[model samples]
Target: MRKKRALAGSGAALALGLAAGYPCLWRHACLTWGATAVEVHREMPGDALLPTAPLVTTRAVTVGAGPAEIWPWLVQMGPGRGGAYTYDWIENLMGLDMHSADRILPEFQDLGLGDTMRLGRNGPVMEVAGLDSGHALVFRSQDGAWVWSFGLYPSRHGTRLVSRNRIQPPDPSPLYRLFSLYVMEPGSLVMERRMLLGIKQRAEEPIAGR
Candidate 1:
């Protein structure tokens, strides 16, 4: 029992030590998750939404459908609309008031420039900075510190959905910068990766199956 305990303790300590020293590796993997080198460096449609970006990350996924078929899912995403195609239970636990929808909602399809999207029922909101049906949708935080861009491209298999984020928080504190580097980047990886997979799953489901 003593030997086993010592081994477990050593393993945990090693993992923590690696995490502390592995911030760059972790950030790199998260920044380029599910993306090719070309895709990671690709200049997406809404890149112009923000000027002088301090940080940027790009991720992507392939869907077995056309851009048109996958567009409705993007159009209706929000806290109270069709949800973010992410972990609703986790968001709700944080009082974000989100729920994933299984089908396209017609009411939310007419999204336009400057439309507001809430992260929670009563939380931070993002504005529609850019939109092009079946092509791209971009959202910017109210403070203009963050911009999220989603783009769809024709691919050999079907379509490639790419998500890019450009961040330049205005006057960020040292603590905030450290927290973002250590916590936000990795945390976003878990949530956003699941979101991409979720959208791919939904877009690929047959209409009859759905």
Candidate 2:
């Protein structure tokens, strides 16, 4: 029975490795949620709006690659493509459909100052207010509640990636405030950690355009 259990565990690990990509590290690196404040719960898209909060958590990761390499992964992020790379399994378990990156097609047409860069099946749905190629990009919902930014910098080893999300305090509601502090903030921390690791693995890999 013990031997059978060990084999089962090994089979599960192998399956995960295949799902992530060719190399094992790509998936393994993302599984570890470092120093997270709260355990994560998965939910489908349109499940429910995030509980309103006063402030959002921000996190950073240093990758062993260049900014050029990391930028593609960020700008082309979505449900199918690279994904937010935050809490993927949680998103999947929640019945939210997981997406693949191969469907991405980013063309540099009509890119202008203050013009929101748009892509994916839904055009301009996700907007980044502050965008600078190879440096930083900020994503915010116009008139919506959540805002996030991705920053990159040259590092001794490669580059540094920073992700920040801002949660606006909701209308007068005590329950909303409480959920933000106890649930959302902690989940954000966990997701941010995973996001960085995912980028790191992809950026460091020996791929074209990196």
User: Which is the leading candidate under TM-score?
Assistant: 1
lDDT tens per residue, model 1, 1-210: 999999999999998887787665567887889998999888887788785798888999999999988999998988888898889998889887779998889999999999997676565579998889899999998877889999999999999999999989555899888888877788788889999999999998964376
lDDT of 2 by residue, 1-210 (tens): 999999999999997666445225432233323312221122212112334534545456778878887787777675544566666678676544444343234752223334443333443344556667777676655555766666676768677676655556655598886665455555656767766787777777755453
lDDT of 2 at 54: 48
RMSD in Å for all candidates: 2.3, 11.5
- Model 1 bad stretches (over 4 Å): 1-12, 207-210
Candidate 1 is scored at a TM of 0.89
Point out the worst 10-residue segment of candidate 2 by lDDT.
38-47
lDDT of 1 at 203: 92
lDDT (CA) per prediction: 0.87, 0.57
Which residue pairs come into collision in candidate 1?
Answer: none
- TM-score per model over all chains: 0.89, 0.60
Give the true-structure RMSD of model 2.
Answer: 11.5
